[model samples]
Target: MSVDREPGLRERKKERTRRAISDVAMRLFADRGFDNVTVAEVAEAAEVSLSTVFNYFPTKEDIFFDRQEDVEQEWGEVVRGRKPGESAVAALRRHYFEALERREPRSGIAEGLVTFHRMIEESPALRAREREIGERGVEALARTLAEEAGADPDDITPRVVANQVAGVYGALYNEGRRRLLAGQSVEEAYPFLLRAARRAFDLLENGVGDYCIRPG
Candidate 1:
């Protein structure tokens, strides 16, 4: 019988190297602006070769948005891991509330003073990239919903419900950013987002029962 060995020191070192590169890149982007910072600078600051940096992060933007893939993965997990009788929307609603309670960074109510928020708002490229990420999230959620409902890929119900759910999150995210830009504290933003989220999900629970409400 072959025993699977745990990741060796070399593998651990590689992971640390990748994280260091990403950390250096994000720091530079936050301080000097994303577009202004070159890959060479990031490589030098990270103490790695330019090719090594690219090996970890294919694009400069990937450095700044390192958490993007995690977001997609978590969305699927929320849907797939819902309680036995829970609906997809219900699972997401619970997840959002839990994040809010913990003030998780993904909740958008994290310290309203995050510099990354300002960076993204200031960079059109990053903003456009964010929209693309949102689209991907919608597509992912749609696919998951279709599978859960055993519907065809082209079915309108899952796509429409996915869009509605994604829209709620997108709106809440932007509203948090707007409030922060307007100088509102996270404390100030919290209640507003909670209220808005409740209303949005309530609408989904009622208005689109056929699509969003779990069947008995």
Candidate 2:
């Protein structure tokens, strides 16, 4: 009989410490402001040393964007595990709607208070960091698409598809943020995002099909 090796106590403890530090940092940023919160204060509140906090998160911005890695992983999974008959655009559209149904915050349709949404929009650093994350996500998605299509990494088709898919998410995220800042509840924002996603993907599916069949 083979015994499955679970994570050791030390590893679990380290993960707990990491979460504690990140949670404290987010709470502080939400209460005061992202720009004003200091790493030392977060370390003290989380009962970890400053070095430990840095060990978990290399920089202050990392704590605020802890879930960025998760988003990239999900995007890769969608492309790599798409159904046999599904196009890349179809796979991404399905993933987005599934996230919406689950009320995932990364979908940008989850219930968050208006203040938090406004605070993110008002911070230039956060906005810039978010754009960087967006680019990373697009690149990851493109790599997965290239694998699925048996194309080179630098091929234009994968890049174009990734741009379209990422553009849909970007538009949805901004619309959700705009509506939340305008005092719309998550319930009110959900349908609008869903409709927008459908329209965006429809345009891509039609446009791509036409382009692929066009004569040289």
Candidate 3:
């Protein structure tokens, strides 16, 4: 069957090749460990050349985190695209809940992700890579917040806000993963996740010793 999914045939072929390689790599990594598989093995198994693998994935970790850059961009956009007059904290809070409603894998609420999470847990290198990704997300959010406030490039407030937001996200994400991996279904998980997230964001909005006051 002649295909018309994307604009061009060449693009379709490229997508097929990328998916094929990714499927092979993930299967091998899941069968073996992430640290044990080399790019050459992945290429060979996928019937691609080593250079082709490097073309798509600069490192083996890149294969695991194929969407990391897109995710970082989304974090910045979440702050930048917040509704007019919305505080950064409010925008992030709304985004967090929306991700839950959509069952986003990044939110750690989606099913079928525990195996992938387990893979990361089993690899020291992947754990370090995940930390690096978190730091990058914080930096991107900080840059957007600084832009919004027209702050000096050296200002610490944006960085502080970014750290606070990132810390909240990291804690919530890990806790959610713990619950989900422990066999709680999405229906059983989100109520507690929402409650905990609300309290966490409340802490950010109204500092310690103060009640949360919704913005006018």
Best candidate per lDDT, number?
A: 3
RMSD of 2: 3.9
* lDDT for each residue of candidate 3 in 1-216, tens digit (9 for 90 to 100): 456644687888888888788889999999899999999999999999999999888999989987889877777788777776678887888889888778888777787777788799899999999898999989898888788777887778888888888888888889888887788887788888889988998898774112111234
Compute the lDDT for candidate 2: 0.78
Lowest summed-lDDT stretch of 10 residues in model 3? Answer: 207-216
> lDDT score, residue 146, model 3?
83
RMSD to the true structure for each prediction, in A, is: 2.3, 3.9, 4.2
Candidate 1 per-residue lDDT, tens place, 15-110, comes to 899889988888888889988999999999988899998898898888888888877667767888877667888888898889877777777768
Query: In model 2, what is the error at residue 75, expressed in angstroms?
Result: 1.4
Candidate 3 at 61: error in angstroms?
0.6
Instruction: Give the higher-lDDT candidate: 2 or 3.
Output: 3
Which window of ten consecutive residues has the lowest lDDT sum in model 2?
207-216
Residue 99 CA displacement from its true place in model 1, Å: 1.0
Candidate 3 achieves a global lDDT of: 0.83
Candidate 3 ranges beyond 4 A from true positions:
1-12, 207-216
Candidate with better lDDT, 1 vs 3: 3
**CA shift at 55, candidate 2, in angstroms?**
0.3
Ranking by lDDT: 3, 1, 2
If ranked by TM-score, best first, what sequence of candidates would result?
A: 1, 2, 3
